[model samples]
Target: MRTAYSVEMVRAAERELMARLPDGVLMQRAAAGLAAACADVLGRVYGRRVVLLVGSGDNGADALYAGARLARRGAGVTAVLLAPDRTHPEALAALRRAGGRTVPGADAEEPLRRADLVVDGIVGIGGTGGLRPDAAALVDVIGETRAAVVAVDLPSGVEADTGEVHGSAVRADLTVTFGAHKPGLLVDPAREYAGSVRLVDIGLAFPGEAELEALQHADVARLLPVPAAESDKYRRGVVGIAAGSSRYPGAAVLAVAGALRGGAGAVRYVGPAGDAVLARFPETLVSTGTPEQAGRVQAWVVGPGAGDDADAVAAVLGTDVPVLVDADGLRLADRDAVRARRAPTLLTPHAGEAAALLGVAREEVEGARLRAVRELAERYAATVLLKGSTTLVASPGDGPVRVNPTGTGWLATAGSGDVLSGLAGSLLAAGLDALDAGSVGAYLHGLAGRRAADGAPVGAHDVAEAVREAWRDVTD
Candidate 1:
């Protein structure tokens, strides 16, 4: 698993570590790592034209010290000092001693135009909102240069704790983060600006849990269900899917398709699209009656092109088994009934659906996904899977929220979420908690989407079909 800590937590850890080390030792360690990474990006330090964007913070000192290292290696380094008077005195002296020259931010264009690489140290973890106007101008100039950009710690102008980018920010080809990952580096908006990330350990120890966690292959593999040798169909688990309407029978077919591929022993589907589902998958136990008459099931998946089937949504929510709500179900299901349930409930919604639930604009949810998802989980007193470029799973607690790292833009296709609903529901039936089920299901679903699309367009059925491959890939 990959973990990210908040700015306050990182600062506390850094301060404790700095107290134990000699003066300037920690900064040297960071500079060394930054210089090494810059060398790698340049391929050869000798005769390279490197430009450093230096600010009035420790990050600027880091850049100056790193530039000194490169200068000693025979690179022609120039520092574009945004705050000449406030720049680190010792760091500037070190750079000058190593033959690195400094140019004011106003005179940066000439050096920037001829640079082979540009290192962004304009802002650090303490920065918020966006870049200052003077700094913003330099970023604009840097954009015109054909240099490969490397940002120190994180891209300038993004919120380290919240991943929000309010205004103009430096977009780097690569970001060299120190000690630990920041929430902004792992989440989107800011994540998009940070093209690629490389972590450099400076030996800062963090005590408590991370603010956010992203599951990798090994973590998902551990969560997946593998039936025991003596386990029968009933012993394994059964997932009940109540979905589809005459208007959208394909939703039911797609949901059942994903459920069949999941680790469930059997899939019992109840909806008006029974005949369509039966045609696609004859093995499914079909019923036209309410979910109450669907016999026994370990978990239930409601919604997914359900139209306005309020009765069906109500009936599924009332069940004692764990239930997942999605699509039309999100609109039809009652919040009080959902909050009133003792059994676990999982709510899956895209940005638009989530906006509707929270009674806000879709842009608001998209802009602040972490806050939105957390608010939804707390309000409903249930787990929420906010589906998008980065799928987030948050339960009704202060625990670290799980972020799914896998996925492609191709997943934006229709009926894709319906498949996810069934897959997660099956995991719930297999006994994984709402958090684990939602994250793992998203992980697999994303990998399957990538495999099925492979740079081309693919249908929802293709993604569902590729889940088996994703499962095997993880297990192996």
Candidate 2:
């Protein structure tokens, strides 16, 4: 699994390492890594034109030092110092000795326009808000240039902690980060600015825990609910899906399709679309009654095109078994009912549904997905899986938030989320906690979506069928 440390955690690690080392040793190590990454990007560094956007912090100092290295290797490096007087004196002298020159931020247009590469050192983790007026103008100049931009640590004007990009920010084709991954580089808004990222180890020790975690194949494989020789249909687990209506019978079919592949022994679908579900997946035990009368189930997936059936959603929530609420369920379920549940509750919401829950604008939820999910999780005292380009799972507890890395744009199609709810609920039935079930389910669903689409448009059914392939690939 890949992990991201918070700024505070990173700084503490850096400080501890720096205290043990000789003065300037850590910075040199960082600069050496930064320079190497830049060299790789440029391919041919000799006689190449490189522009550096230098600020007042250590990030700027690292850029200056890296530029000095590039200058010594025969690159024509020019540092555009945003705060000239506050620049690192030692780094400035080192750059000049290595045959590099400086340009004021005011007269940066010419050098930036003619550059083959640009290095962004304007803001690091310490800085807050968006770009300053002068820096914003310089970013505009960088945009007009054909230079391949590389940011140090993080792109300027991005919320390093939250991945929130406000106003103007530097957009880099590559970012060479030091120590460990920041939350911004792995998330959206800030993630979009950082095109491709390379982590340069500076020998700083990270904490055992980080602010965020992204699971890989090995992690997901371990979390998957594989059956034993002794396991039977009832012993494995049953997933009850309370979904669809006569008007939207496909929802029940789609949910059942997903639940069948979710490692559950049986799928007991209780809804108005029993005939529809049986038509598609005959293995599903269809029920036309309420969730309470649907016999025994290890877990319940409530509301996906159930229309205005709030009573069904309430009944499912009242059950002692783990429950996953999505779609019309998110719209109809009472907040108090969700909070009062003694069993594990997982809420799956898209940006619009999340907005309704938070009483905020859709743009607000979309822009700050991390905050919205965490807030919702804390408020509801449950696990929240915010479904979008980047699927995030956050619980009300102290563990690191899980950010799913496997997703494709084609997943934006209709009924995709309905498939996800059933899959995760089935995982919950198979004995994974809310966090594990949601995170693992998302990982598989995204990979399945990718395999199903393969650069073409795929229906939700195709995506559901591909889950078995995704599971095989993971286990293999």
Candidate 3:
């Protein structure tokens, strides 16, 4: 698993490491790594024009020290001082000693245009909101340049804790993060600004749980349920899907399609679309009744293409087994009832649905997804899987929020979310907790979408059919 720490945690770890080491040792280590990364980006560093956007913080010192290293290597390095008066004195001196000169921010346009690489150190993790007018002007100049940009730590103007980008921010081709990964670097919005990220070990030790966790292949493989030879169909687990109506019968077919391949022993579908579902999947145990009458199911999935089926939503919520509520169920499910349930309840909502639940606009949810998902989980007392470019699963407790790293734009198809709802519901039946089920389901769903699409457009059924392929790829 890939983990990210909050700025406060990172600072504490940094302070502890710095206390044990000699003075200036940590900064030098960061500078060495930064210089090496810059050299790699330049390919042939000799005679390359490198520009460093210097500021008043430690990041500015890092960039300046890295510029000195490049200068010694025959690259013509120049530091464009955003804060000329407050620049790191020792770093500036070191740059001059190594034959690198400084240029004022006012005269930066010419050098920025001619630069082969631009190092962004205008702001660091401590800086918040957007860039100041002077820094913004310099960044505006850098924007027009064809130079490949490298940011120190994280891209400037993006929130370090929650991946929110306010106004003007530096868009980097690559970001060299020190010590640990920030939450901003792993999520979207800010993640989009950070192009590609490389973590440099600066000897800081994180003591406890990370603020954010992203599951990798090994983690997912460990979480996936594999049946033993003695296990029967009922022993493996049965998932009950309460979805589809007269108007949208395809939703039932798609949901069952996903559940059939989710490592579950059997899929029991209870809905008004019984005929349609049976026609598509004869293996499904179909019933035209409420979830309670669907026999002994280990878990239930409700609310895909359910339309105005409020009774079905309420019935599924009342069941003792773990439940996944999505789509129309997100609208119909009572908050008090959901909070009162003893079993685990997972709520999956898109940005629009989440906004409706939060009484906010859709843009607000999209911009601050981490905050929105956390708020929803706390309010409903359930695990929330906010679906988007970066799917996030947040539980009610103080545990780390899980972020799905695998995803593709091709997942934005109709009925794709229905497939996810069933897959996660099946995992829930297979005995994984709400958080694990939601995150693992998202990981497989994303990989399946990528496999199905393969850079081309595909339907939701194609994605469902590819889940087996995704599972094989993971376990293989």
Per-model lDDT: 0.94, 0.93, 0.93
Structure candidate 1, residue pairs in collision: none
**Model 2 segments beyond 4 Å from truth?**
none
Candidate 1 per-residue C-alpha lDDT over 1-476 given as tens digits, one digit per residue, 9 for 90 to 100: 99999999999999999999999999999999999999999999999999999999989999999999999999999999999999999999999999999999899999999999999999999998789999998889888989999999999988888888888889999999999999888777788988899999999998988989999999999999999999988887999999999999999999999998888899999999999999999999998778999999999999998999999999999999999999999999899999999999999999999999999999889878888899999999999999997788999989998888999999999999999999999999988889998999999999999999999999999999999999999999
Residue 291 local lDDT, model 1: 94
Error (Å) of candidate 2 at residue 66 is: 0.9
Assess candidate 1 and give its TM-score to the true structure. Answer: 0.98
Judged by lDDT against the true structure, how good is candidate 1? Answer: 0.94
Model 2, residue 422: distance off in Å is 1.1
Sliding window of 10 residues with minimal summed lDDT for model 2: 122-131
State how far residue 157 of model 2 sits from its true place (Å).
1.1
lDDT score, candidate 2: 0.93
Model 3, stretches more than 4 Å misplaced? none
Clashes of each: 0, 0, 0
